[model samples]
Target: MMIVALMASVSACASTYRVPREEAPPEWREDGKPTGFMPIEGSAKSFPGNHKERGVIMEFAVENERTAIITNTLEWTGPFGGSNIIPAGSPAYARQFSLRMSSNYGSYFGKDMNAYNNPIEWCVPRFDKGDAVCIFWEGSDRARYIDTSGGTPLNASPTSPSGMVGPMPQVQEQAVDFGHQMKIQVIVDTFRSNRITVATRISEGDDWSSLGRTKVMFDEGDTVTLKRFDGEFKLTAHRAGNGEITDVDVEVIKEPKAGRLQTFKDVLEMFMALKAAEAAKAAEDTDESDTASSPEED
Candidate 1:
């Protein structure tokens, strides 16, 4: 019947050129490599306006694999402006994000990159992966990267190339509570010379103690004070040598009733009532010097 209708039209064009083999690709994928929740794709050539209500850019291609660890989760709504992209309960909402890694053969852009100018969207890390393997997010043009889970696991198996690797220096732990002797203020806005180390702990329960240690040497608008004896506290500020700490936190409450101790007790009761009227005029000049040396007083 005409060769079985040309063999059923070449088996329906080889079943439409079969294509079903993509379920082992997740060593790190983002920057428009989406297959599901699709929201990334050239992102309108990098946010082309409507005053940019949303924008997205995600790229993670750790090929010869050097290091490109990524984990991102975001949620947004409401009036949040910029100094560098703020909107999570503004006030310069700082949580953290500034992890950069680039390598076309390395020239720059990898020194444990976490250059926090004003980053705080979530834990963002880019452990320098130089040479080829990539992960890059060029400054927030209204930034956006909706989903990426965990790290390391995408296979093709052809391994043998690892060179540049840098990025592992983060120690942040802050716990503060003031309820007694209370006088805690630590405002450090550094620009240079900054070595602030203030530690305290008083939680009392099965063992949790150490309420002492203060070290300060900040520059810009520096203000440091610590006087505790009233509960929970822990503060740490670092950066005095290898420079790289933009700011630190700590602002406790309640301890404002001194007013110079009621203005020094109203100037010590007006100088003790003017020294008791000059001791009553020196006791009437000692009875007029004992009647002008006696005699003459007769």
Candidate 2:
């Protein structure tokens, strides 16, 4: 029945919109898809040459109307409430593919994905009556969907039309436990490159122990001068390291001119930055209050 709904909802070919590297990402970018897993489709276009994850192999096992199983770790059921056509020529995993991509994944990673892959993958999937399909790759972030119902009973992972709606889940960060204090190193190779590396060391007694490091190559430029890592995330200042994070520690000598080696001086830098931001916000509030009470300009 749900498959029938999909067949009924067809649209013109999608138009492609490539993200310019020089441009800035939109604010309030969505983090992870609010809907946990992305619904899998029958078959995906193979740009295996792109050399990212080909997507883990999964299945669709119908259990109840509300549940389905793919593996011991993966399961699904019921139907995604929304069912609408995704715009055509949507970039697969590119920074601009989804507004939230930048918030957690960073603009650099998105650009790296778009560089070699199709600028946009056709998002519209047509289904015939009784056409059951294989699951979409759960690991793929390119699965930005607003509606999954084509009047069918297919399981869907739906997203808000305006991206994330409602409050975003707060990052529950547990402070990175590394003895006393810790130091973070950010290395940037800025010469028409799209890779960002995160490395950290923790003070142990008197020596600095390497925690772990991770380097993500993006689809574009690095807009982050100094950012707290949060999906692929929350390497925030000196707060906490996400359990899901498995970055290795990196050790690199400083390079002059090209990029600056940003070091977080414990947590003082973060505290001061927060204070500055608060002061700025307070100033703006004062200005707004003054303007509101003043007479309107002609």
Candidate 3:
């Protein structure tokens, strides 16, 4: 009865951005049951190009599968010590060094059912296997980071005037979900008065990169973040006495990119269906319990 709810939820949203089809439905899951994933076999691979060239391009169509795997977030390890590129913090551009957001950091194609085109150009910080991206719809090298602790509908409105979605909760370095396998781990190894050493590793191999150390000097008890270190996660730190600093927080950051885009009518509808499905399941359970414990009339 409650076998594949996640699959149903995603399929509902896909219809909003999904491509119409006349062919037979593709296989769902190995157990002949529906699941919220399509199979993806790829990694965040880089070809050629330096920091400003992007060396990578990413886009996906929800019409392709039930669970959409997309990449809208990009991350870089040390990337040759440090990157000159960072988020512009104005929403006008992705990074201070990039002019790609000409009022459209990302855009939608077609009229009826739209397809998402996220920016992955001039976005690759390193080609030495030190850069990565994350799944938004059609996943890139990895799957996703879903917060299961909260029951908030995925469509819950944010307080932002731009009407962006809610915030993405923070997950530990190597946190893994059921179907979404986290492929990157960014860690802070040494924290001193004036500098911090960072290490980033991918899940597929035993090697780790040393491209992410920060040499910025900070005073004790001062809290700060770096615009240059901004990506899918923010590197936040607090300095301690004697330079033997310890506590460092890496928070997830997500600011939606849009261009010629309107409301997510289809996704909202699907969210409603998901909520309804849960309610139905609860009602069914209650009815069964009532029937089983009912006292027979004399």
Candidate 4:
């Protein structure tokens, strides 16, 4: 009887934690889609040409098998400049920076999906007035949202007279498979006087379960990796510097080999190539116009 009981226990353990057989989903989405949150493109372009962006890019490949790479690029889409403008002691201000995570198959800034496009995952600081950052997941059937602070469904109602702006969707609880392997990247946005703690969980209908590892703290320019696998959980912490990403702690799992971090010189070279191409195109157009307008030599 004891032998039988031991065997049963082992089977249960194996069932609970096993490396995924087929490739896992590109990312772990708590629900189906996000409502209140703006699209990734919208947020990045909020300031027009004045926007400054800094975050890591993750990529997956199928060479020998499935392998992934992470590149941390702290770059501005255009010129880089700024400090938090919210007034001190203002109603719009918060004691801690709000951090939220998002993952997608395409460039977070891209308008279309492509495999060569790196999967963009990063934690962003929400500064929009009256905005609350929340956690979300996408199951096979539908997407769901939850208030990170209150653990409530993120449902919204109409507020404007013109009816142009719709009400925020009310949160509806649902079951989520917490056992699935997940890859999450956390980024630090605003550097305030205080550190911020982030907590996560998985839910099923009205029931919710805590991830074995919960709670992480972050300050500005910090990046951390959160991934779960067969009985093994991995976290990699790092601090971003100019053209450099330094690992903050000892990494446990082996990371896929990576190329050197991009530098300002690389950016300059890109700009130069673009200018040269443009110049060549313009010269060709001018020559064609001259031929069309010139009188016949005879």
Candidate 5:
């Protein structure tokens, strides 16, 4: 009976399982198509003249990967001649500078999706007054936006919008069932001060609606863990103060023995408990052996 009970305990220990980490899908890439005039080029042009002359040129490139080259020439007639190169502050130079800035800035897509040749328009500024330019670059993800102007820089404090630029939180796998508890943890190094909230939602049909929201707070440099166990669902994060949001899609599945969806914490705890139980059993066995070897207490 003891052997059977020990085997059952061992099996239970072995049966302890956790969810595996989910691999986030690659970000979708937007198609890049030409919408405006061809970019400028760096080349020389010859003109009809009495004396042969050559000119030096300078060029500038814009967002569309196009270039615009400007040329300056010098001419001579008699024994000695002087040549002057106009500086950037000059009217001629200013005109070119203004043109380039306007072209590059105006070409930005306001709110209209059609104006943008790129499909990912999240970062694009909605053409309106008080919109400030905001740029976010992560790995291959590049986004530019015009945020609400008049406010301070987004990264003024730890809870500011710029502070969210750090590494993304860790995601855990979940099981699918009607009433089963599904817990998801998003590992973050630091949590914003202005009431950071994490929410879960499902992509029903086309749009995503809310499941619930949880507040996340952590000490300085400590990792913040957010857990949610409810009806099978998807999850996302949102910063209410800055209106920054993260959309994550997750699917729930049910398989006995809890597949790879287990988390590291759960596995570590189980291993530790198993080791402790084994040590206690060994001590008990040694005590029994000593008693059996001893003669009757006389």
Candidate 6:
């Protein structure tokens, strides 16, 4: 029920909020036969569209002395606890959504997925005077909760009148191989449309390759300058090459501008407020129950 619990809040605030782009993705097939593998919702929303739909995808080129704050792989999760809901009207929402959409799939690669504790992860881009692309270490930890199976049980008991508590099994994390280094690339286009497509790839030392790679387009906010790409982008186009679908690689040409960096403070504050409201409602119900159960008064 993580989806239900999280979506409840998202749905309540989604009246005017912009969700990821709703595009019909071509079915993935192998050797021209149907693979019957349809990605989960929100996975393919990384393509071009608008500020709300595609998130912040920036382009970078070689010889540019700017660096993007590469997302911390595996260990990091979205500020909203894997729930995609922020104040839709706030400027922070645009930055947060872009980060979440860009880095949501970093943990699906590698042989051992137990290293990550969060269900989903996001990153905020930063520009620094350095190389076109850079990698950074984010520290390592024991691998636990290999998959979503570690989530709350359907029949879990309530933690309080306002919240539910699930059993946290004492499954100690085991020593596993996890990549803490984040590799980033900013690809610039040929014409000036004020949009950039962010492409990324991950590799585990030489023995392995990209751990859940994806790219999405976003409008360069006021924080950065717009560089010209050769042509315009089609929001509804399918991402395929060589008559078959293939993953994009990390190739670059300069850093166009400085982008925003996302933090968890805003999301944490919102979640706390929602809990306070729930507790207040629960307390009111208790008062009514007490009055109903009282013995007849003189």
Tell me the tens digit of each residue's lDDT in model 5 across 133-215: 22222233222111223221210001112212212211111211111112222212123433244432222122222323345
Better of 3 and 5 by lDDT: 3
Question: Rank order by TM-score, top first?
Answer: 3, 6, 5, 4, 2, 1
Query: Among these predicted structures, which one has the highest TM-score?
Result: 3
Task: Give the top-scoring candidate (lDDT).
Answer: 3
C-alpha lDDT of all candidate models, in order:
0.25, 0.25, 0.26, 0.24, 0.23, 0.22
Predicted structure 3, TM vs. truth: 0.22
For residues 110-195, could you state the per-residue lDDT of candidate 6 as single tens digits?
A: 22211232122111111121111101111122211111111111101111111111111111112211112221222222222332
Minimum summed lDDT over a 10-residue window in model 4 is located at 1-10
Q: On residues 144-206, what C-alpha lDDT tens digit does candidate 3 reach at each position?
A: 211121111111111111111111212211112222132333345555655555433222233
Distance from true location, Cα of 114 in model 6, Å? 30
Instruction: Count clashes in each candidate, considering only residues at least 3 apart in sequence or on different chains.
Output: 8, 40, 11, 24, 10, 16
lDDT, candidate 1, at 84: 19
Comparing 3 and 4 on lDDT, the stronger one: 3
How far out, in Å, is residue 271 in model 6?
0.5
Give stretches of model 4 more than 4 Å off. Answer: 1-261
Query: Candidate 3 — worst ten consecutive residues by lDDT sum?
Result: 90-99
TM-score of each: 0.15, 0.15, 0.22, 0.17, 0.17, 0.18
Ten-residue stretch with the least lDDT total in model 6: 90-99
- Candidate 1 per-residue lDDT, tens place, 1-298, comes to 0000001011211111111122212222222221111111222111111111111111111111112222222233212321211222211001212333444544253332333232222222212211112111223222332112222111111011111122221212221111111111212222334554433221111222222333444434444333332222222334435665444444433222111111112324534544454456557767888888888535
Displacement of residue 73 (Cα, Å) in model 2 is: 49
For candidate 3, what is the lDDT? 0.26
- For residue 135, give model 6's deviation from the true position in Å: 7.8
* Residues 11-80 of candidate 2: C-alpha lDDT, one tens digit per residue: 2332122223332222112233121112113221111111112111111211111111221121222233
